[model samples]
Target: MSFWDDRYSRDEYVFGEAPNAFLAAQSHLLPKSGKALAIADGEGRNGVWLAEQGLDVLSLDASPVGLEKAKKLAAKRRVKLSTKLLDISDYDWPAERFDVVAGIFFQFAGPDLRDTIFAGMIETLKPGGLLILQGYGPRQLEYKTGGPGILENLYTEALLAEKFSALEIFHLGDRDGEVAEGSAHVGKSHLVDLVGRKAG
Candidate 1:
């Protein structure tokens, strides 16, 4: 078992069963119904919430243990969630395949893979599709509440602006606040949230 598998083998959902705060706050902006992709979604929180809102959602993560728990969470919520086990580095990202793509606190190891992942995310969306993402900010290292220990994986407004320049940015900013996401992420943290639409 891997590190995440070991962590998820325990009885609790590390990030709670509710959707991410940023995603929840921006839910009104999502289409009423469409195909949605949740990247690195563990325990089905965000993906399942999208399903509940009537979107056909796919929850992709690298951890089988976590995905299995996600299945149970979907069942408990009486929603259908499609799941796929994938590592973004090798994921065969298809072109223009989705109406919405969400990546909440999905950390990347470095710039190389991060670039590919960012490119893939843009490629995966149809023109005018929505993209919502959130991640730890550079200052997160000072807090250590949750997120990558490496500064390279952290985010900044400039990074998002540059990376997703092809998209029409709707919201891109950083904030410091308390994140009460179960036992794993509970404390004040700094994070960046990004929202945009692919230009037609």
Candidate 2:
């Protein structure tokens, strides 16, 4: 078992069962009902919530244990969830395949890997598709509340702009505040929120 598998093997959900506040707040921006993709969706909190909102959701995670827990959560919610085990590094994200793609607190890569993943996400989205993402900002290292704890694995509005330049950015901001999502993400932290649509 890998590190993430071990982390999720506990009976408790490492990141809590509630959806990320940022993702929940931005839910209104999504299409009322459409095909949605939740990348790196650990334990399926956001995916299940999306399903509750009437979206056809497919959750892709690298951790089988985590995805199993996600499955259980989906069952508890009485919602249908499609899960795929994949590593983003080799994920075959076809072009214009989804109406929405969400990556909440999901980015954890160095610059090179991030560029590839970001590009793949942008490519996989349908024209005018929404991309909702939230992640730790470079300043997160100072707070050390959550995240990969390296600048290379962090984000900034400038980086998002550069990375998803093909998309029309609707919202992008950085803030430091309390984001107690669960035991893993507790206390104050630096975060970046992004909402953008692929150019039609």
- Residue 178, candidate 2: alpha-carbon lDDT: 93
- TM-scores for candidates 1 onward, in order: 0.97, 0.97
Off by over 4 Å in 1: none
* Model 1 lowest lDDT segment of ten: 105-114
Q: What is residue 30's positional error in candidate 1, in angstroms?
A: 1.1
What are the root-mean-square deviations of the candidates from the true structure over C-alphas?
A: 0.9, 0.9
Q: Write the per-residue lDDT of candidate 1 for residues 56-103, one digit (tens) a residue.
A: 999999999999999999999999999999886878778988889998
Instruction: Please give the range of 10 consecutive residues that has the lowest summed lDDT in model 2.
Output: 105-114
TM-score of 1: 0.97
lDDT of 2 by residue, 1-200 (tens): 89899999999999999999988988778889889999999899999998888899999999999999999999999999999998878799989999999998875678887788889899999998999989999788888889998778888889888888888998998898898887999998898988999988
